[model samples]
Target: MAEPAGGPPRAGLVSVVIPARNAEATIAVQLDALYRQTYPGPWEAVVVDNGSSDGTRAVLRSWQRRMPQLRPVSAPEASGANHARNIGCRLASGELVLCCDADDIVAPGWMAAMVETLRTSPAAGGALERRSLNGTVALAARPPKESDSLLDTFGFLPYPAGANCGFHKELWRRLGGFDESYRYGSDDVEFFWRAQLAGYELGFSPHAVVHYRLRDGPLAIARQLYCYGRSHPRLYRDFRAYGMPRSRIGEAVRAWWRLLVHAGDLAATPERRSAWLAGLALRAGRVAGSVRHRRPYL
Candidate 1:
């Protein structure tokens, strides 16, 4: 957990590390948002470019020239975002680490809010509230205000979305960062569970907000759901091993029921409904892929 050489001291707070892959379209917007942060604290934006074949490198270079705080690190392998994030964490010098995806947009006050909350609390990791881009809904159930303990926050822990989270650098190192063996999903779940078991404090910050973009079309939505479903078994196994709550069966059933109910909404429109059904088919395909390639978490 010592600061890497040639960088600032470990006391520096909140390094924002973004792991990006083929994000040429939105990386600039995210970088610009980072530049506009009002935190005024010691921070750095580490962009781990994960073998992006797209013009993502060009975008990062342009941003780097404009902002000295923006540091670009190349990750030539296509191992996935988790690997890129590990590389970023290793290179980062801040005492605390914040992660953001390239496609998402962080509010101007987001960084300052989380940092302040973490500094005041004894939590190892802090959660930020998330709202969808289309203004559809909040991503997770809001936690009650009176709860001061991590156990009271356990229900909200499962709600910890990867994009809006912050953690202490020492705790992150102790937890071994992210498990790279996970190829497509559940890396966040695995890491958070490990952190909780290690007695690391977890807290929530509703003021820190991020806008997450929804999947583009029906095909994309279905693919995402299917991948999520396939990853559930492994997540359940991990949760069980860590003595954490397991909701795999319940989640799977609810997802199926929701899909059935929403089937009518999508089918109500002839043109768009077909696209929705196609997306469902893609989800099914991903589920099949997951089953075929299922790997034991242990």
Candidate 2:
């Protein structure tokens, strides 16, 4: 497929959509990082204020004076992040669409690398460098050295971090945007699976990097994992549409055992405890979700 022609040549405008919800402290840094991007093509940043009660709106408005390419939009329904993202995307003037979270810092050259990859490849995710709030790099969830697919969303070395992924605007329209019903998580996972099922190859970029802030503490991480786990039943049901078997019982049992052993380990540091509980929460959530969706997903 050819790069969709826009008023801008070379690569056309790359629209970056950011979904913000009470992210007053972090949104400005993300916008600043976008301002620093060396991507020469025409690009725009659309921030969808997803019912933030903080000063997120004022901060975005303030940044507009500095980054004229930035556009502020609203997703006031208190729906889902996907809804906010779709809203921002519809407001885009570019053919290539990028999605980033409100709390990430894009590396220099991030935009150019992702846009170039999507220009030549089907779908692409920029590399991610995760850090704690104190700026320490996370030991896990590191970006892969090669490209990945929706199949890799679990039990694999590579998967697209939603904060660092993008694809063609046409592709988004064809997929009908993300499943807004997925309020907790896995909306991106479903989209990736749908796109790959539609035959679009998912690509990865090492040079296109973003610094992500990991969840702050134990409860935070555990809650995040719980939501992810609860989303699995629906995720698996969606996968069945593409020919996966109905039963994932055996695989789920093994995973449950693994989490049990992990939680029983002696080392009890906050981070380690968090991981252990998170694993358990995920298993519990998957089981609950599986029951709710009437699929033996767990």
TM-score of 1: 0.78
TM-score, one value per model: 0.78, 0.86
**Predicted structure 1: lDDT:** 0.66
Task: Write out the backbone clash pairs for model 1.
Answer: none
lDDT of 2 by residue, 146-185 (tens): 3323225554223476788998888888889887898887
lDDT winner among the candidates?
2
Worst 10 residues of 2 by lDDT: 1-10
Model 2 scores a C-alpha lDDT of 0.75
lDDT of all predictions: 0.66, 0.75
